[model samples]
Target chain A: MSQIFHPSTNTLSKVSIVSVVLLLGGLGYGLLALNRSPYVARTKIPFDQPVPFSHKHHVAGLGIDCRYCHTTVERTASAGMPTTETCMSCHSMIWTNAPMLEPVRQSWATGKSLEWTRVHDLPGFVYFNHSIHVNKGIGCASCHGRVDQMPLVHQENTLYMEWCLDCHRHPEKHIRPRDKVFEMAYQPPANQLELGAKLVKEYKVQKLTDCYTCHR
Target chain B: MKRLPWLLLIGGSMLMMGCRQDMHDQPRFRLNAATDLFGDRRAARPLVQGTVARGMLKTDTALWSGKVGNKNVDQFPFPITREVIERGRDRYNIFCSPCHGLTGHGDGMIVSRGLKKPPSYHTDALREQSVGHIYNVITNGNGSMMSYASRIPMRDRWAITAYVRVLQQSQNVKVSELTAEERRKLEGAQ
Candidate 1:
């Protein structure tokens, strides 16, 4: 028998490739584990909106509901932005001729969305469902902070898996009416901790601590 | 050697899949839905589970109080109230009013634009639902709605529930107020 060997890839290059691959793999795993644990509060989201909508003016003064502009939030994937016409509905008739509000008025007349900058965006790899949280009795302030006070909305909470699981672990204490889903804390029923724990247990919230919850 | 990477990738994915339960069909929260819908027989036993009364299921009760150690709610550092409701209402109108309408009739402009309108709050099923149940819908949202859980507060979510109840009641109230004599008695004028 006669043996002939022909190699396209060099041994030296293959060894170098292996070493590089190992180094990269170690770095990726390290980052993965670091991100696994929750990071609290919004050291992340640089939230800013276009129109600078004021919850104080609308809610405190006019008595609007959180669902009004973010309409589809109760049943859809996005807690949708109000259509330009939605703003015009009232602004056109109510503020009808206000000079300062002309931009909003114009947007409504033209049918363009507000182009609001997302303040509390979790990663694309993350999965978030509003109906689940709303149904689970979670509030808005749990992630967005006290939005009523903000003239221009900012991401108040970190929205990490830890932030979400902490409450997923106990829904009743944090659970309240559907409207108050955005509340900062569980005030009513006095013993929020106790109540939250009760809801979690009652609902049997398990593996909320599991990685696949927020992670895809 | 060429197929080793493929084998490893497939193996790793299988391992990850094996660690988790079936989340795809997990029973989501629904109005007036039984706690046992998720099949936790132990948690479903008590006669009075809705209230804070504790009996056999001590662990679930602890989860209610935020004493579950590793797991807790992300509520404010305080309790929820009407103030929270007011704020939530403001946001809801700005965000939800377009589709849900002011009264939650699900007949917003979008519906008029040919989007499907939702059930009216005046419906008996929705009327019978709890405020907490409605809040869950608002936060996690329903069929077409998105999670305002990120934008609205938990307390304000409850407030919206309160308001929705008001709408429901207004639309379906007894629809028959009593006479002056009964009204006087109700007011304690006697």
Candidate 2:
């Protein structure tokens, strides 16, 4: 082997300096790349809002139907939010003085929409049509965490793409009656495997096993 | 290792495609239901047919009123139960309560907002209406009321009519003669 020469003290220090500089350059590049592009994040973002609302009270306590507020869910792509007027129609007379409800009243008076914290959010690339899914009898609880039992609505589910496609690939696993849409802690029915299998066969639901469908 | 990684990636990629057409070959669940029993031939069989034989015997012809379309043809057979009532209540709350109000009093939130108030269930017109007529209204939808026939099954509508009657009776119970003990209980004498 060719003899590797021993360096002088100054030369050795220079090598160390170069190595440290290179390592730090690589690290700085990584962090800058991370900060610049949003791709490095491991968690989904939680949105903030003006007022806190509870699905638990209406759905669990009073048994108010899910369709009452999210009216267009069964027939339209977007489940329309409760307009300020919808709140004022009831809250105006029912809980006229509740401080939390003041924002709703204010929004109504100003003819402005409430900046409701979106609990169930999807990525911009993912095209989720609430109407089509609901019309096809896919329960709301299939994706949304049990909204009926939640007090201050937050994104209870991680809503990862994999979590969604799991059901899209095998909808039979999540098929249920339309009424159980808001029920939390609900499990796939006892005969779920069998029923899901039947639905899979009957509806001929094609599993979305393509990458481009999501990435695009 | 390269091949393994490539295969997994391909497999995972494949899972992200399609609308769920894979499990078609899986054995389907068989339910012992009447509807399923005749599932294959349901379309082949006619939905509603009236078979009538004009009387060769002359004296049997008699006048009829109210529902007189076909006396010779048998009435439709339906079984009403508590389960159906519960199911109807659930379905009604979801669909009907939006317009008709929770108590069927025409005071629902939608009505309060702008929608028209539907006919009261407490009225004698609704109380004495046949289950079939009520079913027709639900299926065909009356006035501003949209049809729920598609969303609610045939049996549940009958159950809803039954529940409506219960509501009417609750609202219109007349004060009548009571036994001594019953009167005491009514008077809260305990």
DockQ of each: 0.07, 0.06
First chain TM-score for all predictions: 0.68, 0.71
Candidate 2 backbone overlaps, count: 21
Q: What share of the true interface contacts does candidate 2 keep?
A: 0.10
Q: What's the lDDT for candidate 1?
A: 0.60
TM-score of each candidate structure, all chains considered together: 0.45, 0.48
Positional deviation of B136 in candidate 1, in angstroms?
A: 29
What TM-score should be assigned to candidate 1?
A: 0.45
Candidate lDDT values, in order: 0.60, 0.62
Model 2 CAPRI rating: incorrect
Best by TM-score: 2
